[model samples]
Target: MAALILDPLAALGRATLAACRTIGDVTLFALEAVSHLVRPPFYGRLFWRAFVEIAWFSLPVVALTAVFTGMVLALQSYTGFARFNAQSTIASVVVISLTRELGPVLAALMVAGRIGASFAAEIGTMRVTDQIDALTTLSTNPMKYLVAPRLLAAVIALPLLVLVADVLGVMGGWLIGTYKLGFVSAAYLKSTFDYLEADDVISGLVKAAVFGFVIALMGTWCGYRSKGGAQGVGGATTTAVVTSSILILALDYVLTEAFFAQ
Candidate 1:
Protein backbone atom coordinates (compact mmCIF):
# COMPACT_ATOMS: atom_id res chain seq x y z
CA MET A 1 0.00 0.00 0.00
CA ALA A 2 2.79 2.43 0.84
CA ALA A 3 4.59 1.59 -2.39
CA LEU A 4 1.48 2.18 -4.45
CA ILE A 5 0.83 5.52 -2.75
CA LEU A 6 4.43 6.60 -3.20
CA ASP A 7 4.39 5.61 -6.86
CA PRO A 8 1.37 7.79 -7.59
CA LEU A 9 2.87 10.70 -5.73
CA ALA A 10 6.09 10.35 -7.67
CA ALA A 11 4.22 10.27 -10.95
CA LEU A 12 2.33 13.42 -10.01
CA GLY A 13 5.56 15.21 -9.15
CA ARG A 14 7.15 14.18 -12.41
CA ALA A 15 4.17 15.38 -14.39
CA THR A 16 4.27 18.73 -12.61
CA LEU A 17 7.95 19.17 -13.42
CA ALA A 18 7.42 18.18 -17.01
CA ALA A 19 4.67 20.77 -17.36
CA CYS A 20 7.01 23.44 -15.96
CA ARG A 21 9.75 22.41 -18.38
CA THR A 22 7.38 22.55 -21.36
CA ILE A 23 6.23 26.02 -20.42
CA GLY A 24 9.83 27.16 -20.08
CA ASP A 25 10.72 25.77 -23.47
CA VAL A 26 7.78 27.51 -25.12
CA THR A 27 8.68 30.81 -23.46
CA LEU A 28 12.27 30.52 -24.64
CA PHE A 29 11.17 29.68 -28.14
CA ALA A 30 8.87 32.72 -28.24
CA LEU A 31 11.69 34.99 -27.05
CA GLU A 32 14.09 33.55 -29.59
CA ALA A 33 11.58 33.93 -32.38
CA VAL A 34 11.01 37.58 -31.50
CA SER A 35 14.74 38.25 -31.39
CA HIS A 36 15.29 36.59 -34.72
CA LEU A 37 12.44 38.55 -36.26
CA VAL A 38 14.39 41.77 -35.75
CA ARG A 39 17.74 40.43 -36.95
CA PRO A 40 19.39 40.37 -40.40
CA PRO A 41 19.10 37.69 -43.10
CA PHE A 42 15.37 38.04 -43.05
CA TYR A 43 13.39 35.59 -45.19
CA GLY A 44 11.12 37.82 -47.23
CA ARG A 45 9.82 35.04 -49.45
CA LEU A 46 8.91 32.86 -46.49
CA PHE A 47 7.12 35.76 -44.83
CA TRP A 48 5.09 36.44 -47.95
CA ARG A 49 4.18 32.79 -48.30
CA ALA A 50 3.05 32.58 -44.71
CA PHE A 51 1.09 35.83 -45.00
CA VAL A 52 -0.74 34.59 -48.08
CA GLU A 53 -1.46 31.23 -46.51
CA ILE A 54 -2.65 32.64 -43.21
CA ALA A 55 -4.60 35.57 -44.66
CA TRP A 56 -5.59 35.16 -48.30
CA PHE A 57 -6.16 31.43 -48.20
CA SER A 58 -8.29 31.87 -45.13
CA LEU A 59 -10.49 34.56 -46.69
CA PRO A 60 -13.19 32.34 -48.19
CA VAL A 61 -13.80 30.41 -45.00
CA VAL A 62 -13.83 33.55 -42.87
CA ALA A 63 -16.20 35.34 -45.19
CA LEU A 64 -18.62 32.44 -45.37
CA THR A 65 -18.62 31.96 -41.60
CA ALA A 66 -19.08 35.66 -40.89
CA VAL A 67 -21.92 36.07 -43.37
CA PHE A 68 -23.92 33.20 -41.92
CA THR A 69 -23.17 34.28 -38.36
CA GLY A 70 -24.55 37.75 -39.05
CA MET A 71 -27.62 36.39 -40.75
CA VAL A 72 -28.34 34.16 -37.79
CA LEU A 73 -27.73 36.98 -35.36
CA ALA A 74 -30.25 39.13 -37.18
CA LEU A 75 -32.84 36.36 -37.25
CA GLN A 76 -32.38 35.58 -33.60
CA SER A 77 -32.45 39.20 -32.53
CA TYR A 78 -35.57 39.85 -34.52
CA THR A 79 -37.30 36.88 -32.96
CA GLY A 80 -36.31 37.82 -29.42
CA PHE A 81 -37.32 41.46 -29.81
CA ALA A 82 -40.56 40.66 -31.53
CA ARG A 83 -41.80 39.16 -28.28
CA PHE A 84 -41.51 42.59 -26.67
CA ASN A 85 -42.51 44.61 -29.74
CA ALA A 86 -39.00 46.11 -30.01
CA GLN A 87 -38.09 44.92 -33.50
CA SER A 88 -36.43 48.25 -34.25
CA THR A 89 -33.47 47.22 -32.08
CA ILE A 90 -32.53 44.31 -34.33
CA ALA A 91 -29.95 46.29 -36.33
CA SER A 92 -28.21 47.60 -33.22
CA VAL A 93 -28.07 44.15 -31.62
CA VAL A 94 -26.74 42.47 -34.75
CA VAL A 95 -24.03 45.06 -35.34
CA ILE A 96 -22.92 45.35 -31.72
CA SER A 97 -22.87 41.61 -31.09
CA LEU A 98 -21.11 40.87 -34.37
CA THR A 99 -18.52 43.62 -34.06
CA ARG A 100 -17.96 43.38 -30.33
CA GLU A 101 -18.07 39.64 -29.74
CA LEU A 102 -19.14 37.10 -32.34
CA GLY A 103 -17.04 38.29 -35.27
CA PRO A 104 -13.71 38.24 -33.46
CA VAL A 105 -14.45 35.14 -31.42
CA LEU A 106 -15.66 33.03 -34.33
CA ALA A 107 -12.99 34.18 -36.75
CA ALA A 108 -10.27 33.44 -34.21
CA LEU A 109 -11.65 30.00 -33.48
CA MET A 110 -11.91 29.18 -37.18
CA VAL A 111 -8.38 30.31 -37.95
CA ALA A 112 -7.06 28.60 -34.85
CA GLY A 113 -8.63 25.33 -35.91
CA ARG A 114 -7.43 25.60 -39.49
CA ILE A 115 -4.10 27.43 -39.34
CA GLY A 116 -2.98 26.21 -35.94
CA ALA A 117 -3.50 22.57 -36.87
CA SER A 118 -1.69 23.05 -40.16
CA PHE A 119 1.26 24.77 -38.49
CA ALA A 120 1.67 21.98 -35.95
CA ALA A 121 1.41 19.27 -38.55
CA GLU A 122 3.88 20.93 -40.89
CA ILE A 123 6.41 21.65 -38.15
CA GLY A 124 5.88 18.29 -36.54
CA THR A 125 6.57 16.58 -39.84
CA MET A 126 9.75 18.59 -40.23
CA ARG A 127 10.85 17.56 -36.76
CA VAL A 128 10.03 13.91 -37.35
CA THR A 129 11.91 13.93 -40.64
CA ASP A 130 14.94 15.68 -39.10
CA GLN A 131 14.50 18.64 -41.46
CA ILE A 132 14.70 21.08 -38.60
CA ASP A 133 17.97 19.53 -37.50
CA ALA A 134 19.27 19.78 -41.05
CA LEU A 135 18.50 23.49 -41.03
CA THR A 136 20.43 23.89 -37.81
CA THR A 137 23.38 22.00 -39.30
CA LEU A 138 23.25 24.29 -42.35
CA SER A 139 23.74 27.31 -40.07
CA THR A 140 20.21 28.55 -40.65
CA ASN A 141 18.56 29.45 -37.38
CA PRO A 142 15.37 27.41 -37.21
CA MET A 143 13.72 30.08 -35.08
CA LYS A 144 14.27 32.66 -37.79
CA TYR A 145 13.68 30.45 -40.78
CA LEU A 146 10.75 28.44 -39.51
CA VAL A 147 9.07 30.23 -36.63
CA ALA A 148 9.47 33.99 -36.77
CA PRO A 149 8.09 34.53 -40.25
CA ARG A 150 5.00 32.53 -39.51
CA LEU A 151 4.47 34.27 -36.20
CA LEU A 152 4.86 37.69 -37.73
CA ALA A 153 2.56 36.79 -40.59
CA ALA A 154 -0.13 35.63 -38.21
CA VAL A 155 0.11 38.76 -36.09
CA ILE A 156 -0.28 40.98 -39.12
CA ALA A 157 -2.85 38.96 -41.03
CA LEU A 158 -5.35 38.11 -38.33
CA PRO A 159 -6.46 41.69 -37.76
CA LEU A 160 -6.93 42.23 -41.47
CA LEU A 161 -8.94 39.03 -41.71
CA VAL A 162 -11.08 40.13 -38.78
CA LEU A 163 -11.76 43.44 -40.46
CA VAL A 164 -12.98 41.68 -43.55
CA ALA A 165 -15.05 39.34 -41.42
CA ASP A 166 -16.63 42.30 -39.62
CA VAL A 167 -17.66 43.95 -42.88
CA LEU A 168 -19.04 40.75 -44.41
CA GLY A 169 -20.90 39.95 -41.25
CA VAL A 170 -22.56 43.36 -41.22
CA MET A 171 -23.49 42.99 -44.85
CA GLY A 172 -25.05 39.65 -44.05
CA GLY A 173 -27.11 41.25 -41.34
CA TRP A 174 -28.19 43.93 -43.72
CA LEU A 175 -29.39 41.39 -46.23
CA ILE A 176 -31.35 39.37 -43.69
CA GLY A 177 -32.89 42.41 -42.07
CA THR A 178 -33.99 43.93 -45.35
CA TYR A 179 -35.19 40.81 -47.15
CA LYS A 180 -36.26 38.29 -44.55
CA LEU A 181 -37.44 40.69 -41.86
CA GLY A 182 -38.85 43.27 -44.24
CA PHE A 183 -36.91 46.15 -42.71
CA VAL A 184 -35.94 49.09 -44.93
CA SER A 185 -32.31 48.95 -46.06
CA ALA A 186 -31.62 52.59 -45.27
CA ALA A 187 -32.98 52.34 -41.74
CA TYR A 188 -31.10 49.10 -41.08
CA LEU A 189 -27.75 50.53 -42.16
CA LYS A 190 -28.36 53.74 -40.27
CA SER A 191 -29.15 51.90 -37.04
CA THR A 192 -26.14 49.63 -37.44
CA PHE A 193 -23.87 52.62 -37.98
CA ASP A 194 -25.38 54.69 -35.24
CA TYR A 195 -25.10 52.13 -32.45
CA LEU A 196 -21.61 50.78 -33.31
CA GLU A 197 -19.00 52.89 -31.51
CA ALA A 198 -15.35 53.12 -32.43
CA ASP A 199 -14.41 51.41 -29.18
CA ASP A 200 -16.32 48.29 -30.13
CA VAL A 201 -14.39 47.90 -33.37
CA ILE A 202 -11.06 48.62 -31.72
CA SER A 203 -11.69 46.10 -28.96
CA GLY A 204 -12.42 43.36 -31.53
CA LEU A 205 -9.19 44.06 -33.39
CA VAL A 206 -7.24 43.88 -30.13
CA LYS A 207 -8.85 40.53 -29.37
CA ALA A 208 -7.99 39.32 -32.87
CA ALA A 209 -4.34 40.20 -32.40
CA VAL A 210 -4.17 38.41 -29.06
CA PHE A 211 -5.85 35.34 -30.51
CA GLY A 212 -3.45 35.36 -33.43
CA PHE A 213 -0.44 35.39 -31.11
CA VAL A 214 -1.83 32.57 -29.01
CA ILE A 215 -2.61 30.42 -32.06
CA ALA A 216 0.84 30.83 -33.59
CA LEU A 217 2.64 30.32 -30.27
CA MET A 218 0.75 27.14 -29.45
CA GLY A 219 1.25 25.77 -32.95
CA THR A 220 5.00 26.44 -33.00
CA TRP A 221 5.51 25.07 -29.49
CA CYS A 222 3.66 21.84 -30.20
CA GLY A 223 5.38 21.28 -33.54
CA TYR A 224 8.87 22.14 -32.33
CA ARG A 225 8.64 19.61 -29.49
CA SER A 226 7.04 16.72 -31.38
CA LYS A 227 8.63 13.35 -30.95
CA GLY A 228 8.05 9.67 -31.79
CA GLY A 229 6.75 9.54 -35.38
CA ALA A 230 3.50 9.92 -37.33
CA GLN A 231 1.49 9.45 -34.16
CA GLY A 232 3.35 12.27 -32.53
CA VAL A 233 2.64 14.63 -35.41
CA GLY A 234 -1.04 13.75 -35.32
CA GLY A 235 -1.19 14.28 -31.59
CA ALA A 236 0.51 17.65 -31.90
CA THR A 237 -1.94 18.81 -34.52
CA THR A 238 -4.93 17.87 -32.37
CA THR A 239 -3.39 19.47 -29.31
CA ALA A 240 -2.60 22.62 -31.26
CA VAL A 241 -6.20 23.07 -32.36
CA VAL A 242 -7.74 22.29 -28.98
CA THR A 243 -5.31 24.35 -26.95
CA SER A 244 -5.41 27.34 -29.28
CA SER A 245 -9.19 27.35 -29.40
CA ILE A 246 -9.49 27.19 -25.63
CA LEU A 247 -6.86 29.87 -25.15
CA ILE A 248 -8.59 32.13 -27.65
CA LEU A 249 -11.87 31.87 -25.74
CA ALA A 250 -10.17 32.36 -22.39
CA LEU A 251 -8.17 35.33 -23.60
CA ASP A 252 -11.26 36.80 -25.19
CA TYR A 253 -12.88 36.87 -21.78
CA VAL A 254 -9.84 38.48 -20.19
CA LEU A 255 -9.62 41.08 -22.94
CA THR A 256 -13.30 41.83 -22.76
CA GLU A 257 -13.01 42.36 -19.03
CA ALA A 258 -10.04 44.63 -19.40
CA PHE A 259 -11.65 46.60 -22.21
CA PHE A 260 -15.05 47.02 -20.59
CA ALA A 261 -14.33 46.64 -16.89
CA GLN A 262 -15.76 50.01 -15.93
Candidate 2:
Protein backbone atom coordinates (compact mmCIF):
# COMPACT_ATOMS: atom_id res chain seq x y z
CA MET A 1 0.00 0.00 0.00
CA ALA A 2 2.80 2.44 0.85
CA ALA A 3 4.65 1.44 -2.33
CA LEU A 4 1.60 2.20 -4.44
CA ILE A 5 1.15 5.61 -2.85
CA LEU A 6 4.84 6.47 -3.03
CA ASP A 7 5.10 5.33 -6.65
CA PRO A 8 2.31 7.67 -7.83
CA LEU A 9 3.75 10.53 -5.82
CA ALA A 10 7.16 9.93 -7.32
CA ALA A 11 5.72 9.90 -10.82
CA LEU A 12 3.92 13.16 -10.19
CA GLY A 13 7.13 14.71 -8.88
CA ARG A 14 9.03 13.61 -11.96
CA ALA A 15 6.44 15.10 -14.30
CA THR A 16 6.51 18.38 -12.41
CA LEU A 17 10.29 18.53 -12.60
CA ALA A 18 10.27 17.84 -16.31
CA ALA A 19 7.74 20.60 -16.91
CA CYS A 20 9.86 23.05 -14.95
CA ARG A 21 12.92 22.11 -16.97
CA THR A 22 11.04 22.64 -20.24
CA ILE A 23 9.88 26.06 -19.14
CA GLY A 24 13.44 26.99 -18.11
CA ASP A 25 14.79 25.88 -21.47
CA VAL A 26 12.22 27.96 -23.34
CA THR A 27 12.95 31.02 -21.19
CA LEU A 28 16.67 30.67 -21.74
CA PHE A 29 16.22 30.28 -25.47
CA ALA A 30 14.00 33.38 -25.65
CA LEU A 31 16.52 35.39 -23.62
CA GLU A 32 19.38 34.33 -25.85
CA ALA A 33 17.40 35.31 -28.96
CA VAL A 34 16.54 38.69 -27.45
CA SER A 35 20.15 39.31 -26.46
CA HIS A 36 21.34 38.75 -29.99
CA LEU A 37 18.77 41.21 -31.28
CA VAL A 38 20.63 44.21 -29.82
CA ARG A 39 24.17 43.14 -30.68
CA PRO A 40 26.34 44.43 -33.52
CA PRO A 41 26.10 43.43 -37.20
CA PHE A 42 22.33 43.33 -37.32
CA TYR A 43 20.98 41.32 -40.26
CA GLY A 44 18.87 43.91 -42.05
CA ARG A 45 18.39 41.87 -45.21
CA LEU A 46 17.24 38.86 -43.29
CA PHE A 47 14.91 41.04 -41.25
CA TRP A 48 13.41 42.54 -44.39
CA ARG A 49 12.87 39.15 -45.95
CA ALA A 50 11.20 37.90 -42.83
CA PHE A 51 9.10 41.06 -42.65
CA VAL A 52 7.74 40.58 -46.16
CA GLU A 53 7.20 36.88 -45.70
CA ILE A 54 5.28 37.27 -42.45
CA ALA A 55 3.28 40.40 -43.14
CA TRP A 56 2.57 40.28 -46.84
CA PHE A 57 1.94 36.61 -47.29
CA SER A 58 -0.42 36.51 -44.31
CA LEU A 59 -2.93 39.15 -45.37
CA PRO A 60 -5.33 37.18 -47.52
CA VAL A 61 -6.38 34.63 -44.94
CA VAL A 62 -6.58 37.22 -42.21
CA ALA A 63 -8.86 39.39 -44.33
CA LEU A 64 -11.15 36.52 -45.20
CA THR A 65 -11.40 35.43 -41.60
CA ALA A 66 -12.21 38.95 -40.50
CA VAL A 67 -14.93 39.48 -43.09
CA PHE A 68 -16.65 36.21 -42.40
CA THR A 69 -16.41 36.60 -38.65
CA GLY A 70 -17.99 40.02 -38.75
CA MET A 71 -20.81 38.78 -40.91
CA VAL A 72 -21.54 35.92 -38.55
CA LEU A 73 -21.35 38.16 -35.51
CA ALA A 74 -23.81 40.59 -37.00
CA LEU A 75 -26.15 37.80 -37.93
CA GLN A 76 -25.99 36.29 -34.49
CA SER A 77 -26.44 39.64 -32.77
CA TYR A 78 -29.52 40.36 -34.84
CA THR A 79 -30.94 36.97 -33.95
CA GLY A 80 -30.50 37.48 -30.23
CA PHE A 81 -31.28 41.19 -29.89
CA ALA A 82 -34.39 41.18 -32.05
CA ARG A 83 -36.31 39.50 -29.25
CA PHE A 84 -35.39 42.31 -26.86
CA ASN A 85 -35.76 45.14 -29.47
CA ALA A 86 -32.07 46.03 -28.98
CA GLN A 87 -31.07 45.68 -32.61
CA SER A 88 -29.52 49.14 -32.77
CA THR A 89 -26.79 47.88 -30.49
CA ILE A 90 -25.66 45.31 -33.08
CA ALA A 91 -23.32 47.80 -34.69
CA SER A 92 -21.73 48.61 -31.35
CA VAL A 93 -21.42 44.96 -30.41
CA VAL A 94 -19.70 44.02 -33.64
CA VAL A 95 -17.21 46.87 -33.44
CA ILE A 96 -16.25 46.26 -29.84
CA SER A 97 -16.07 42.50 -30.33
CA LEU A 98 -13.74 42.82 -33.29
CA THR A 99 -11.53 45.57 -31.91
CA ARG A 100 -11.32 44.31 -28.35
CA GLU A 101 -11.06 40.55 -28.83
CA LEU A 102 -11.88 38.45 -31.86
CA GLY A 103 -9.78 40.34 -34.39
CA PRO A 104 -6.56 39.93 -32.46
CA VAL A 105 -7.20 36.40 -31.25
CA LEU A 106 -8.29 35.03 -34.61
CA ALA A 107 -5.56 36.78 -36.57
CA ALA A 108 -2.91 35.40 -34.21
CA LEU A 109 -4.30 31.89 -34.50
CA MET A 110 -4.22 32.11 -38.28
CA VAL A 111 -0.62 33.27 -38.24
CA ALA A 112 0.33 30.54 -35.80
CA GLY A 113 -1.14 28.02 -38.16
CA ARG A 114 0.61 29.52 -41.17
CA ILE A 115 3.87 30.85 -39.75
CA GLY A 116 4.37 28.78 -36.60
CA ALA A 117 4.28 25.42 -38.36
CA SER A 118 6.54 26.78 -41.06
CA PHE A 119 9.07 27.94 -38.47
CA ALA A 120 9.17 24.57 -36.81
CA ALA A 121 9.50 22.73 -40.10
CA GLU A 122 12.16 25.01 -41.53
CA ILE A 123 14.34 25.12 -38.43
CA GLY A 124 13.81 21.48 -37.66
CA THR A 125 14.97 20.70 -41.16
CA MET A 126 18.05 22.82 -40.69
CA ARG A 127 18.78 21.15 -37.38
CA VAL A 128 18.33 17.63 -38.71
CA THR A 129 20.33 18.41 -41.85
CA ASP A 130 23.39 19.63 -39.88
CA GLN A 131 23.11 23.20 -41.23
CA ILE A 132 22.74 24.62 -37.76
CA ASP A 133 25.88 22.80 -36.69
CA ALA A 134 27.67 24.07 -39.79
CA LEU A 135 26.63 27.65 -38.88
CA THR A 136 28.14 27.29 -35.43
CA THR A 137 31.27 25.79 -36.96
CA LEU A 138 31.58 28.80 -39.25
CA SER A 139 31.39 31.20 -36.27
CA THR A 140 27.86 32.31 -37.10
CA ASN A 141 25.32 32.42 -34.33
CA PRO A 142 22.26 30.57 -35.57
CA MET A 143 20.01 32.21 -33.01
CA LYS A 144 21.11 35.66 -34.12
CA TYR A 145 20.91 34.97 -37.82
CA LEU A 146 17.77 32.88 -37.88
CA VAL A 147 15.62 33.35 -34.78
CA ALA A 148 15.91 37.06 -34.09
CA PRO A 149 14.80 38.23 -37.51
CA ARG A 150 11.80 35.96 -37.48
CA LEU A 151 10.86 37.12 -33.99
CA LEU A 152 11.14 40.77 -34.92
CA ALA A 153 9.23 40.31 -38.12
CA ALA A 154 6.40 38.50 -36.40
CA VAL A 155 6.13 41.13 -33.71
CA ILE A 156 5.75 43.79 -36.34
CA ALA A 157 3.55 41.82 -38.68
CA LEU A 158 0.84 40.53 -36.37
CA PRO A 159 -0.33 43.88 -35.07
CA LEU A 160 -0.55 45.21 -38.59
CA LEU A 161 -2.53 42.18 -39.58
CA VAL A 162 -4.82 42.63 -36.58
CA LEU A 163 -5.34 46.28 -37.47
CA VAL A 164 -6.38 45.38 -40.98
CA ALA A 165 -8.57 42.64 -39.69
CA ASP A 166 -10.26 45.08 -37.35
CA VAL A 167 -11.18 47.35 -40.23
CA LEU A 168 -12.32 44.55 -42.50
CA GLY A 169 -14.30 42.92 -39.71
CA VAL A 170 -16.12 46.15 -39.01
CA MET A 171 -16.75 46.59 -42.70
CA GLY A 172 -18.28 43.13 -42.84
CA GLY A 173 -20.66 43.97 -40.04
CA TRP A 174 -21.61 47.19 -41.76
CA LEU A 175 -22.37 45.36 -44.98
CA ILE A 176 -24.68 42.88 -43.34
CA GLY A 177 -26.42 45.43 -41.18
CA THR A 178 -27.18 47.79 -44.03
CA TYR A 179 -27.90 45.31 -46.82
CA LYS A 180 -29.69 42.54 -45.01
CA LEU A 181 -30.90 43.83 -41.66
CA GLY A 182 -32.52 47.10 -42.84
CA PHE A 183 -30.05 49.32 -40.95
CA VAL A 184 -29.15 52.73 -42.32
CA SER A 185 -25.53 52.77 -43.49
CA ALA A 186 -24.95 56.21 -42.03
CA ALA A 187 -26.40 55.30 -38.62
CA TYR A 188 -24.43 52.06 -38.36
CA LEU A 189 -21.21 53.88 -39.12
CA LYS A 190 -21.98 56.54 -36.56
CA SER A 191 -22.83 53.98 -33.87
CA THR A 192 -19.69 51.95 -34.58
CA PHE A 193 -17.51 55.04 -34.51
CA ASP A 194 -19.14 56.40 -31.39
CA TYR A 195 -18.78 53.21 -29.40
CA LEU A 196 -15.16 52.67 -30.45
CA GLU A 197 -12.73 54.30 -28.11
CA ALA A 198 -9.03 54.52 -28.88
CA ASP A 199 -8.34 52.09 -26.06
CA ASP A 200 -10.49 49.41 -27.59
CA VAL A 201 -8.28 49.28 -30.64
CA ILE A 202 -5.11 49.82 -28.66
CA SER A 203 -5.97 46.97 -26.32
CA GLY A 204 -6.28 44.52 -29.19
CA LEU A 205 -3.07 45.74 -30.72
CA VAL A 206 -1.27 45.23 -27.42
CA LYS A 207 -2.58 41.69 -27.25
CA ALA A 208 -1.46 41.17 -30.83
CA ALA A 209 2.12 42.11 -29.99
CA VAL A 210 2.21 39.69 -27.08
CA PHE A 211 0.55 36.95 -29.08
CA GLY A 212 3.06 37.51 -31.85
CA PHE A 213 5.89 36.94 -29.41
CA VAL A 214 4.29 33.80 -28.07
CA ILE A 215 3.76 32.39 -31.55
CA ALA A 216 7.32 32.97 -32.62
CA LEU A 217 8.77 31.79 -29.32
CA MET A 218 6.90 28.50 -29.36
CA GLY A 219 7.61 27.90 -33.03
CA THR A 220 11.34 28.50 -32.73
CA TRP A 221 11.60 26.68 -29.43
CA CYS A 222 9.98 23.55 -30.80
CA GLY A 223 12.08 23.70 -33.96
CA TYR A 224 15.38 24.44 -32.23
CA ARG A 225 14.95 21.47 -29.94
CA SER A 226 13.40 19.06 -32.42
CA LYS A 227 15.15 15.72 -32.61
CA GLY A 228 15.22 12.69 -34.91
CA GLY A 229 14.57 13.26 -38.63
CA ALA A 230 11.56 14.00 -40.81
CA GLN A 231 9.15 12.46 -38.35
CA GLY A 232 10.58 14.61 -35.60
CA VAL A 233 10.19 17.71 -37.73
CA GLY A 234 6.54 16.83 -38.31
CA GLY A 235 6.01 16.33 -34.62
CA ALA A 236 7.63 19.66 -33.82
CA THR A 237 5.38 21.38 -36.32
CA THR A 238 2.30 19.89 -34.70
CA THR A 239 3.53 20.72 -31.23
CA ALA A 240 4.30 24.30 -32.17
CA VAL A 241 0.84 24.93 -33.59
CA VAL A 242 -0.99 23.30 -30.70
CA THR A 243 1.10 24.96 -28.01
CA SER A 244 0.90 28.41 -29.62
CA SER A 245 -2.87 28.18 -29.99
CA ILE A 246 -3.36 27.14 -26.39
CA LEU A 247 -1.07 29.88 -25.07
CA ILE A 248 -2.85 32.52 -27.18
CA LEU A 249 -6.20 31.56 -25.67
CA ALA A 250 -4.93 31.31 -22.10
CA LEU A 251 -3.07 34.60 -22.38
CA ASP A 252 -6.10 36.31 -23.93
CA TYR A 253 -8.10 35.85 -20.74
CA VAL A 254 -5.24 37.02 -18.55
CA LEU A 255 -4.66 40.11 -20.70
CA THR A 256 -8.35 40.94 -20.86
CA GLU A 257 -8.55 40.83 -17.07
CA ALA A 258 -5.45 42.92 -16.68
CA PHE A 259 -6.84 45.55 -18.99
CA PHE A 260 -10.55 45.52 -18.24
CA ALA A 261 -11.23 43.98 -14.88
CA GLN A 262 -12.71 46.00 -12.06
- Give the best candidate by lDDT: 2
Worst 10 residues of 2 by lDDT: 46-55
**Model 2 over residues 140-210: C-alpha lDDT tens digits?**
89999889999998998899999999999999999999999999999999999998999999999999999
lDDT of 1 by residue, 1-262 (tens): 8999999999999999998998898889889898998998999999999889989999999999999999999998889999999999999998888888888899999999889999999999999999999999999988899899999999888999999999999999999999999999999999999999999999999899888888898998799889999999999999999999998989989999999998
lDDT score for residue 74 of model 2? 98
How much does candidate 1 score in TM-score?
Answer: 0.95
The alpha-carbon lDDT assigned to residue 1 of candidate 2 equals 92
CA deviation > 4 Å runs, candidate 2: none
User: Any idea what lDDT model 2 has?
Assistant: 0.95
